[model samples]
Target: MQIRLGGLETSEVAALLAEHVEDMRRYSPPESVHTLDLDRLRTPDLTFWSLWQEDVVLGCAALRELDPTHGELKSMRTSHAHRRRRVAAALLDHVVAEARRRGYARLSLETGSPAEFAPARTMYAAYGFTPCDAFGPYVADDFSMFMTLDLADQPAR
Candidate 1:
């Protein structure tokens, strides 16, 4: 899969993002839903990417800068047809590599606590992300699982 920077013009990316928000709404309470909307993804500090194979969009993910040295993983979703094929993994590797290039020491993310999110949590763990307390605008919530990875221990990509 080829991973590259994306913009709002990518309809597949927008569709996947909508699916992500809808899924979050289904699994999380309104007050606890933390996914960013399309507009927010356009922020200067957020770098969005899409994974594609030929003309097909496999998935999309984004990195939102929480600070100069830290970033939050956002909107990570692999298309249903692309699931179980390492699409998400590729997107994640791309994000982590970019974070390292941007001089970020830490990469953190928040996902749902439900069984529906088990695969996502597992994916994060496989990439060396360890559970952590809520960072940024988040508070400790039983329905949320927070994780972080330290870039210091990682070699250049």
Candidate 2:
């Protein structure tokens, strides 16, 4: 699969993000869903990317800069047909590599604590992200889970 930057204007990417947002709504309560819609994702602080093969998109992910030393993972979604094919893994690897390249000492994320998000939690854990208290503008919520990875502590791969 090939990963490229910025497909926000494309119909396929828009549909994928729409599906992702709708899936979030289906699992988490409205107040607890923290997904960034397409418009919000277009902000300068965030860089969106899509993994594609030829003309078809397999998945997408975003890396958002929180500050010079820290970054946040956002809008990670693997298309329904691409699930379990390592699309999320590849996207995450891209995000982490990009964060390190940008000189970020750490990367973090916020996700739901519900069963619907268990696979995501497991994926993050496999990438060395540990559960942590809230960060950025986020607050402690029983329905939310926060995780972070200390890039500085990671051995070069």
Candidate 3:
């Protein structure tokens, strides 16, 4: 599969973001839903990407700059048909590498702290992310699980 820079023009990407937001709503309370909408994802600070194989969209993810040395992983979603195919992991690997390329000292994310999000938590753990206190504008919330990876500590993957 190939991964490319993503914009808001494609219908498939639009649909994916719609489904992602809907799923987040279904799984979390309104106050706990942190998934970005299309407009929010288009912000200058966020760089989005789409993973594809020939013509099929496998998944999409984004990295939002929190500061010069930090980034937040956003909108991580693998298409239903692509689940268990390692699409999310591949996309994450790319994001981490990009963070390192950008000289980011850390990469962090916030995911639901429920059973529905267990797979994501496990995957992030496998990539060296560990539970951490919230950063950026985030506040303490039981429903949100924050994780971070220290880019400086990682040997080349």
The RMSD (Cα, Å) of candidate 3 is: 0.9
lDDT of 3 by residue, 1-157 (tens): 9999984678888887888888888888999999888889888999999998987788999999999999999999998878999999899999999999999999999999989999999999999999999899888687899999999998758
* TM-score to true structure, per model: 0.94, 0.97, 0.97
- Against the true structure, candidate 3 reaches a TM-score of 0.97
lDDT of 2 by residue, 4-78 (tens): 999998999999988998988998888888989889989999999999989999999999999999999999999
lDDT per model vs. reference: 0.89, 0.93, 0.91
When summed lDDT is taken over every stretch of 10 residues in candidate 3, the lowest stretch is 7-16
- What is the model-wide C-alpha lDDT for candidate 3? 0.91
Which candidate tops lDDT? 2
Q: Compare candidates 1 and 2 on lDDT and give the better one.
A: 2
Which runs in model 3 stand beyond 4 Å of their true positions?
Answer: none
Clash counts per candidate, in order, are 0, 0, 0
Sort all candidates by lDDT, best to worst: 2, 3, 1
Candidate 2 least-lDDT 10 residues: 148-157
